[model samples]
Target: MTELRNPVIRGFAPDPSLVRVGDLYYLANSSFEWFPTIPIHRSRDLAHWEYAGHVEGAAPGGSLAGVPDSGGIWAPSLSWDGERFWVVYSIVRSVGTPYFDADTYVSTAPDVSGPWSPPRRVPSHGFDPALHHEEGRLWLLNLQNDHRPGGRRFAGIVATELDRETLTPVGTTHLLLQHDRLVEGPKLLKRNGWYVLVLAEGGTGFEHGVRVARSRNLTGPYELDERPLMTARDDPEWPLQKAGHAELVETPEGEWFLSHLAARPLKTPEGPRCPLGRETAIQAVTWDAEGWPRLRQGNARPTITVEVPDAEPPAFWGAGNCARSPHPPAPDNAPPYYTLRSPAAPSWTDPTSRPGRLRLRGHHGPDSLWSHHLLARRITEHHTEAQVTLQANPTTFTQSAGLLLWYNTAAYYALDLTWAEPEGEAQHGQQWQHTGRTVLALTTRDENETRRAAVQEVDADTPLTLGVTVHRAEAQFWYLTDGTRTPVGPALDFTRLSDDHGTRLRFTGAMAAIHAVDLVDASFTADFTDFRVICTSV
Candidate 1:
């Protein structure tokens, strides 16, 4: 028997779409504002996967510049005809104001890895564009935003025919399905002479679920399934609420599976929020005798462990270890900046430098999640650790530089250094003022403290090396000066740092970010000499 694995892809891989070409399988997911949106991964067996390539590079002129914190690549769909491979996705600039625009773009490559052509915008008015080729013609399926007077946010799905050669609309669009409530991530499939439309409804939240509709014609006057295909209520103990945004694929052996997004809370008892954001999960799919699809059950719940074939010898995996000259990893087709809550400038990050350094412009106070020029990457895994070296002279008590784990405007954690006041300032000097003498501090915002730090103090920073460790079990903050360890109060509690129910960290993702804030008019920069992640053994 063949077994399917869990989390076929990890770390901020949301809105998954998959396609199988011959003996190989390829997957693509949302990339949001980060350039090179739409990353593709390949796998021979459903288990082990490798990064294949990206659809487009960063938007021209950095159109997404200064706009950080999760708002770029949306849902993307991948499809393969007998000849070429195609990828379609949406781009949203921010979370508010015309929050989104449905611009469907397409790119084709003879193979997954290649000189991919520049993306061409499909002349269609919809989001989450999906391609379905039947006979000799191409059909486009998408989520139609409800724009009627006093209409709802997302109303329904739309379908239209496209020229097979150019992939351009050939005729007028047709409304395939509409439910004032059901919206987003629409995927179309054909089975046993019927066209099936799958969608996610209830706004990707704890109440989110997958629903299906069927029709005999491509332009559907469809019928809804009496029940949802999947839902968060499947298991009460499991905190994952929204378990939709799925794509279906048939394995080489003719078996089937569903790839979708699932969240797990950080703390179990009190249900800690997720720090890294929503992650991808996979499950085996089986069709009932009636031709309806059903998921296998064994008190079924999302898990980290999935079974697949073993790796062959001479695995040819990518390489680059710590202490060696760092290899330049490809840029993710998603946002790479860590964001603060303020509307600040974009941080300066040098990804090409050996042991690259990140320079953050200074800002005031702790409210840095909304808009601060901070350099960050999206956090995706359950258990991960990262380290960096910081160099800055805190001339004023207000001037400081350090590392942070940011999640939008309301939640985050940081470890930074502040300078001590000049000597004789205690009694002889007039009025006390903040100084940048380099004192170590740890700050966090969670359900318990809200915005206050559980642990904050003055510590030595003579050497300037700092490390932040995030274990599946806990989170720790440590610092080293001249290669000697300086102890802080204690390891802060990290049990509540997950997106189990998708609330606390509104976005269930995290990044290794650097920031300089509230400094006293001096330029402060933090050089990250060594940053490494040690993945747990499988």
Candidate 2:
């Protein structure tokens, strides 16, 4: 028996929608305000997964700028008709408001990593929208969010039959089910003689769980199952917590699995905070005599490991249908890199500038939600190290760049290289400025409080190496000076940059980023090379 891990895809990946086409399985998740919207992952065996590519132009405007934190692209539904690939999602401009201010769009591609078609706007009932295809018709299933002052935010599940050619609703919308409990994330399927509707019930907190409803007709009165299909909400001490938002798929060899989202939170002095954010997990499911799908017979609890059927690799495993393999044994085809707000710009982050070097051009500071000239990756582990070798000479204090450990605008830390005047040296703006020297500074931000420690008069010509080492819940920043390891700022409480610690409900994890910003002119460019990140304690 081959055992598989709980989180098949880790680090800030949530609201997973899975689909299996041929021998390869593809998964898509929400991106929120981050760039490269709607990340699609590829996998053969349900347990092992890797990044495939993102839905290019998933956002209509080529930008998600100005969208608040936790407010861009919500749950993206990835589906495939007999021919091309279809994706439907909502672009959320606001959160927890009377007016959700969200728009739904649909896009198609011949392959996963697309030359995707421009997104076309659809009727925005609410978020977590998914497409259901059957026989010769297409349907859109979504959560009806009532944004009124006093209303059941999660009213119920609704469906609309769409025109197959235009992917637009052809007739009136249907309210499939209205439940008293908090139920959303609806996924539909037909088995044997029953039409099963899988749903994520309870809020996406410690109360999260998977529930099911079934009916003979596509649109009708549905009955909820007495027991939950899968969850770890009741077991707080469990390794996997907050498991919900699930989608199921059957293997070619007659096996069933549920792909969902779960989180690993650390116990802190204030409370438990999930620094790695919600991740994608898989649970092997079984059907009972009553035709209801379940992970277990009696009680449905998520497992840390499950045995999967053994199968040999097929010729098309990494071929035409799969589009860019790297599906597990290989490093994800979608490189271990990402940008914020807008997509990774060639003008801002140029990896081809110098051989093996990444040049980051500064645009806006870390606080900017729209145009952040930053490139980062998800912080997957508690104990990890992030370092970069940078060659930069900032002429003014306004221009700076270096390593960043970011959660959101209000919570983050940075170790940057910039120019600072000597002690007792006076300067006025850019004019009458006293000669200053290059410096490496470690700055930390806890909510609105910002503190920094600097090492000025450093070598301006030679490349400087800056690093951050994390162990357990603390992170210490350091810089290599004169061949000596010198700690920069005081040890920071890493738990502060967590989802629960923030003022708002955050859905993404802490990210290790490298960025440059010229608050003055946005002209200074920084060259970074030999960037490395290692997880010592996973």
Candidate 3:
């Protein structure tokens, strides 16, 4: 058997479900709110991977409309039952919603590079569904809600046999295992004549862990492991605490390995911080002399390299640079001219007035926010620098236009041009609100916070260029006004914004745009040119 490497895929690729079809290996990861959710990658060897395709086309919208940084896909399990490729995943509007309302669905295709079928919701009332096939019969194992008459606070595992051909449930649903503890992310496997059910428990937080239960019969009184297969308490060096939601696979060479999500905490004295969210890692799995599985490393930290039987292949996924075509290049690396978040009105129009420019019709005030007029691109890497040039005239006192780094409604950073009439200057002199203009704003369920920093603002009539760059791991921000670059704020401790709880700065990935607040019934138009995104690959 050959050894495997750590983090074959990195950065936001969590809740891994791996399947090896012959010599080729495929992996799927969770894409919380990012569109084209469920990123799929293919590898000839476990150590090298390439972006194969996305599970779903665009992010689900309408009744299925994806919520900004909220709705869309979650932990997905991918498998091949010798005939077709199947992917099962959960879709939810919000985290706190009832489980029954959150639906689980499946998509299949003859091949992985697929003209995949539209999602069909499995008749299951849960999230994170895993399908297992055994003895010529198919079965579905998933986490069902604890909504019974007087049940536990969280859900537990439930199973039902399904028709092998139709992929439909065939028998009555049976509760396989129900503990008072919160249990989810169940994967079933048959080993050594015993049906083993592996699951994640303790919620997906610092308390997370992986446990196992076994039963002689497919649906009987199963016995749980005296100890969890993996836990943060067992190994302190593990970069992430609360590591769970695991799937095991064997290489073509017959070596066993486990892939799971691990959180990397912000190295702060205050405690662990996870702004970027959980990332995926792999480790060797070994069975003791007694046939029970043990993680070879004891802890969850992934090794950097591994040895495999097959020769290494050349890199495939992200070698070339992506360019913006069809549209004119943005002037500086500033945000795009217009951006919309679940638009209420049709305010965006591609107009001939500016010749090859997208125009946004400004509405009344910030209260009339949420209209669709924003232009955005995916911000996947940690270090990104962008710039844009804009010409705008504000007629209303509330009218403003500028660059914004947005992650849904809750977290954002913006630099905008606001018009203010001086105290004694009548209605003649208008001041460009420059210093104390940067908006480090966040809106959470509990409170809304905005930290204003000084910036050199460009006046209303002149066309000005603005740019902002984010170096993620180092937590630094650089900005340029009119073409001269300068650092902004004290280097922000960005690691605090990781997805793990603690800091309020939730990293919902990054997007840049230029937008208009309430305009007090006046027309505001901005021409944007030369939009660019630059980054270094992992």
- Candidate that would win on lDDT: 2
What is the descending TM-score order?
2, 1, 3
Worst 10 residues of 2 by lDDT: 320-329
lDDT of 3 by residue, 193-250 (tens): 8887878877776777777788998886788877778768466556555577787777
Q: TM-score of every model?
A: 0.79, 0.93, 0.77
Q: lDDT for model 1, on a 0 to 1 scale?
A: 0.61
Tens-digit lDDT track of model 2 for 497-518: 8777856767777878899998
lDDT of 2: 0.80
Tell me the tens digit of each residue's lDDT in model 1 across 26-80: 8887766433456677767766566676664424333454343456557888899
Q: Say which prediction, candidate 1 or candidate 3, comes out ahead on TM-score.
A: 1
C-alpha lDDT score of every prediction, in listed order: 0.61, 0.80, 0.60
Better of 2 and 3 by TM-score: 2
lDDT for 111 in candidate 2 is: 86
Please say which candidate is ahead in TM-score: 1 or 2. 2
| Weakest ten-residue segment in model 3 by summed lDDT | 320-329
